[model samples]
Target: MKNVIFLIIFLFCLNSYSQEFKNITIIKSDKTEIKTLGTFVYEDDLIKGIKTKKNNLLISFQDVNKVFINKETYLVKNYKFKKYLFLKIINGNLSLYKDKKNYYLENNELGLKNIKKDEKRLQFVFKTGEVSLFINKCKAATNELYNKRKSLILSNLKKIINIYNTCDTSSKIQFADEVIKESNRPKEKVKFGLSFGLMKLKTDYNQPFSIEGSDKNFTFVGGKVYIFSNIFQEKLDANLSIDYFFRKNYQINDIDYYIKNSTQFTKLTIGANYTINNISKLITPYFGISGGLLLSSNSSVKLISKYLDLPSRHYTLSNELIYNINVGSYIYLLNQKIDLIFEYQPKINTKLSDSINLHNNSSSFSSLSFKLSYIF
Candidate 1:
């Protein structure tokens, strides 16, 4: 089959690309000549952190400068990170180096990094980010690589490094604008899910206004979508959410009301939630504020009094701005692909609306709400 042949070729390519650094020759950073350390094999335990004792020879990867294995060479350079092994592939005034995940360029004055093609594809921000590093020591070389092909591929990068190593001017590292912008920008994390909760509402819905029979105590099930991002700081995240709630009440009795009346309203809220992050990897506790602007509301009110019986009438309410305080946590599961979110909002001022042509122009209310959401 064609599938079997393709899989065989893929496995063969992977095996052919496997690198082995069995032997090591330690050279000091100060250009001192040391006796050759010939026999460091796979049995000696390579990559044992910074320091490792092997065959009575204590080798500290951080302290050493150059480590040569046969014809291949690895240079230890701590430009941005702590000392790590960088295999020097091309050597000169400008040299090309490669590690397990990234490729780097280093010269007398600067060391630049270019993330491997598959290392980072769609990430917006990270601790150490992907970048298209450039050197302007030679204008001709820079133009040829950047303008002619306009790519950040590995082959073009090698040409630029080779040409710049032979340049007559001073070499300095400069990151392109696109690389710098992407390094610091945090992309929005969007989540869509369903939320079901209850709201302990303090409203004037004594009896005259109760949509779906909910008076002071109400329950709501809604579809919520949230956009979360760590905008400014690592400890805080700025988030936005839109919720369409279906609020209803059940089990009505005559003993709780002064008059036989009920009122109900439907509303959609667009709100922001600012939360703390990284309390724990699995259970991240967050406490923040939720604020929103209500576009409008549709309310139906019915009053059945012994003296006066009134039919249910619909009222359209205007817009209002309100803010509430909440505390919550994000529970991550399945390698953080699924988030189980829980939020609790204490009693806060809930402005019903601007005008509804009702008994009151705009009534101020308070609500205690609890919502649980599952984000996939």
Candidate 2:
């Protein structure tokens, strides 16, 4: 009875693990069907493939006539010995297709015949009666050939429009507009956001002078607004931000001498961030290094003069050039228009002045900040 119960539990776990993968159906050219239990995609080769628990399977582009995933069908179409996978039929005999190509380099170790590079291009297909037009990138083609391709595309598009007019003209205008918009949409290139949080000083000071009674932990409340531009489109970003910290006061006492001090720190940062641009995903993480100038000053100091009289004095700490490293993750919500970000940044100890230093007799300063940012 114990062995039977263990076997039943093992089977139950195996069934649950198998349910994690989606079912895929591949229809071959010979009218045979391959029913597989795994996720599949079109990778480097001109074929549709899947990685299964047992082994990887690659079906030739010519052999695969259709693929069915979750009741949705993808038709395999061939042009000039290259296969294109069309997702579904659009309005008035139009369809969306993905074109993939592999490029080989002459100096590559694998030789010129072996593919060393790959790219996927979005394509639109328009078909009417016996006419078909596939619109793709033609930047490298000659002007004459480019114009010819464009003319053919427009001509076929007109036929599709005429067919739509004869049928459902109610949705033609909206459908045509959607197709045009999708074809000409620009890629996302820039993002802007604002962040607010508290910054805490985490430096250990080897002070030449001592304060008899003082709080060692110094924290400042501040906010920053930043703009990020894609430097390498989806991989890296150039970041710029202006940070403003509110003024903070510290009271120091040294046995019969009392001092009142206040300070404000502002900085302008220029940095680069390596971002994983999975905007379509729920969470994205990034890390970066930045160098900036901290515009700082000591506002007013009240202390007892040598004559046993209290006096107020104003002094300035020189502007500081500092470097820092930051790590953060963005929680995307509401179609990525808004984000809740959590960040931890550690500032490297940089010298502020040759004379006076805040809290510490040493010239260097350091801070750790926790921030939350929203991006639109």
Candidate 3:
């Protein structure tokens, strides 16, 4: 829970305070162009830059020929008996457009038509025949794509739309070559992987200690999921991981196995990672910090003295959370589809200390770890 709060605060800081479009271009029906470098709000098919232009600043749907926001071009078109700003994505004899989350196709000869939106962005979520059948009005386009009926999806949806807009032989040949290159483009994806590492624990003793045989060194296993991101830049990302380990210490050369301490814990780590440089490179270095909960079968352990025959004593639950630092390098393989990772954590959490042990200023439990992971 602490980890979640920290992540939320970090993202909240990165996002801009407002969603305003500036330096946006607008073309009137009269063919006059205006470049409004001032901040403007767009909503309800109107550009609310209302100002001292004496009635020229407030822009309505009927007044625009086209509006440009960077490379995107939006035109005021009619949809469902109402005026709307639609982004034209493909232009040919038959044109394709997007209005918000929906897509519409239009042509002078053929009436406006809507395309069924099943945009999951999955690699192959839909079949070509499914889309071709939906837009059967374009027989030439369908016949050309009928051969690869099974490969149609959001990633290649543009290619199909481009082919439909141009039924000519030259355009068809051009799209065929373009589709091959599109396959290599990188996309935002969630990658899964596993990691195994060794944990090293240290104890700071202020005075003489009685209990012994605590396993200071142990191994832990974990799995991680990485979500590719461009939060601030291209290589920035966020990931989640879980790890489990067991540690115990006992007194030896005694009749009874006097256990000093025993703990089996599982932790959840939520964090962000930023690659040092371009991710396409052979060796990509990255660093991150994560904070999360520590769940243990036994947080406070009881110990009994054999020789003294004293009553059982219990340790206090100093802290119930965990956090760590991760610095790693990725060794890319098989065309960057796979990565072998090596990571080091200088600190897992401060002391993991409770108030009791810290109050007496006698003991401290701390750790540092190393891990190796395989991501594909």
The top-ranked prediction according to TM-score is 2
Candidate 1 structure quality by residue, lDDT tens digits, 1-376? 9999999999998765433213456777777644443333221222322222235454555557777767887777675555666778788877777765456666665565544454354532211222233355566565555443434456666676677667776546544443446567677666776666666655444333442333376666666666766464334555555544454433333332222323344335555544455767777776676666544354322233323353323333445566656677777777653333444333323233323344433334556777777675
What are the per-residue Cα lDDT tens digits for candidate 2 across 255-281?
544555566778777776677656547
Q: Candidate 1, after superposition: displacement of residue 364 in Å?
A: 3.8
After superposing candidate 3 on the true structure, give the runs of residues whose Cα lies further than 4 Å from its correct spot. 1-187, 205-215, 250-259, 278-280, 299-306, 309-319, 335-363
Candidate 3 Cα RMSD (Å): 17.6
RMSD vs true structure, all candidates = 16.9, 15.6, 17.6
Say which candidate scores most in lDDT. 3
The lDDT, on a scale of 0 to 1, for candidate 2 is 0.50
How do these models rank on lDDT, best leading? 3, 1, 2
